[model samples]
Target: MFSILIAGRLPQINFQQVSETQFVIPISDIDHVNHLVVFMTGQIPFPENYGGGGNWPSAEGPSWIFLGKITNVKPSAIFKIGKIKDIESKIGSSLAPTLFSGFQHQTAIPTDGLLGISVEPLSQLDQQIQPHDITPSTVASNVEFVSKMLNNFVNYVTSFVQNVPGTSEQIVPLSIIQTWYNNFQRRITENPNFWR
Candidate 1:
């Protein structure tokens, strides 16, 4: 993760491997604004070539939990804003001065002063990941992709694995692996511990 000092006042944060882009810093440095601090990091996976069936988006960035004065509060533990004490402004341009002057609407917000459910820009979170760049999504995506490819190549390496005539092995695609996992889950739930 990298932290860039913007105008020598605002610290734009970035995360590695889908972590928080910005940190709370405890606001200990600012004698004027002192509040509990926190950090967040997250990223949007590439919609295509990301995972099987492409569950996530292609964009990448860090998560946030900005600390600001509770300008307004609502029934659903919502806080308006006072001043951005940190860069955890998961708020997008669709709202506020960039778009409108209303509280952002989202499903989840960190208690450390996150405003809404929306996430922040990719640059502020981690330097390695950008809107279109892909460093690494889940530690499993790489393992899965490479292993699957290798398995395919290996199948082509040996003939019949011992001269078993008329018999051969076929490589399975990642999508098929996904389907297998889902089916296995269903079977497991039907018995939980069958035969054992």
Candidate 2:
């Protein structure tokens, strides 16, 4: 079990392990955002020379999330944007962004985590991750990527509230957005995994 806190609102979210290190936070439990935040950590020990099927664990996490995490090692995040609808044609989903985290640095041992989701470029959220020395430009590139992603997210939320059914023009507070932005900055610089 772990507690996830998003900046501004939706603090101290308790999530259960769906499988290994992967935990799914249902949208209903959240007051903000509409999609599921899929948090996953720990590295699966794939064979040194991965051949095929049985070489990997049955409970493998999402490929992009896992591979991206392992390669970078520094706690990182990405988002996936999509809509959710029901058979009855009702807005069964909030069309919110899904946040996913990867562990700190590539390591054989399982490790720490971060937050985010989507097609945004994979970004290292923590700098103190050891062994792997990422260049300053890489860090800058990641920051630029995340900054753009956040802007896009804000725009998506704005458009979604105006057009989605049953949705009131409730906007995610700017303070919250700033908080989220700051939170990422803080984590990247501080590497504070509240879990510890």
Candidate 3:
């Protein structure tokens, strides 16, 4: 079983069967601005080698944008849904009823605004490789670059602040900011959940 918790509202909960791997969520009532947290209930594990993936289909339909994936290592994921462009188009019309018939009884899938989430086997996802698919090396390089850039930026800003005349240390203390940057960089290095 899987459940979706839409945060920042009345805490709506939507449930879906594991068999119905693909489904759509309606965002019209919430103004299409919220975070969706999808997670497994652990009542049933995914069949041997299966994994779950998510996608945001284009408002016009046909094209689906890859969001991210959920696996045993990372069972839950948070999706930030922002204001979608051209939301006046009819929703679910182009999408098959099987994609969202599961949720029809609880929350009616909006005809004009909907977000699609798909959970499929890892093998199926491998067949359709996305350009932005993440890799371990890519993540490491990004973190290294970010850490170096932050350090350089902090040094530059600190130097500029010190050189300024009549600038009170109380306004912006170099030590505090530098310490904070150092701590943040350390935390990110040690734990990937710092961003969360």
Candidate 4:
């Protein structure tokens, strides 16, 4: 089974099941949203011949784009929804007719301001490299650089006083801050989902 969790303005959350591998959540429900998360809950794995991915609306031809696959190793995915106007401007042209002809008759495509999400069995997912796609090494290097910068910031802050002001002893000690950062770094290294 698959489920979708949508979070909008602070403290507002919506959940829905993708019954039969398809579901629609009205745009109003997620207006001014913070994040969109999707995951699979079933014990059975996807078939060898089938893979799962999401479909997002395109501005041109009112078509849709495949937003890549969500696999068993990474069952859950999070997305930050961009503004409609920005998305329309960035998404250049509509998809080829051959790719979307089969979906022309589907009722899932929203007419009003509703957002439609679906999981389908796709054999291939446009394997050709796109200029926008980033490599795994690039991501790793970026993460490493950020981690180093954060560590430097923490060390600089800790070096200042090493104790709370106007006190004989160290209140809110430096060790605690260091320990917290170490634990956070370890958790992120082990599994990036700790915050999730």
Against the true structure, whose TM-score is highest?
Answer: 3
> Compared to the true structure, candidate 4 yields what TM-score?
0.45
Which residue segments of model 1 deviate by more than 4 Å?
A: 1-135, 160-196
Instruction: Determine the backbone clash count of candidate 1.
Output: 19
Cα TM-score of candidate 1: 0.18
Which candidate leads the pack in lDDT? 3
Tens-digit lDDT track of model 4 for 102-193: 23323443443333444555445435121122112267666776787577657655565455568776545667677767877675544433
User: Could you tell which candidate, 2 or 3, scores higher by lDDT?
Assistant: 3
Candidate 1 structure quality by residue, lDDT tens digits, 26-141: 11233343222212222333222211000111012223322121111110111212233221233231211221112222223233322222233323222211111111235676
User: lDDT of model 1 at residue 188?
Assistant: 37
TM-score for every candidate vs. truth? 0.18, 0.22, 0.46, 0.45
Ranking by TM-score: 3, 4, 2, 1
Candidate no. 3 TM-score: 0.46
CA RMSD per model (angstroms): 18.5, 18.6, 12.0, 13.3
Quote the positional error of residue 182 for candidate 4 in Å: 47
lDDT of 3: 0.52
Q: Global CA lDDT of candidate 2, please?
A: 0.31
How well does candidate 3 score on lDDT at residue 24?
A: 61
lDDT of 4 at 128: 19
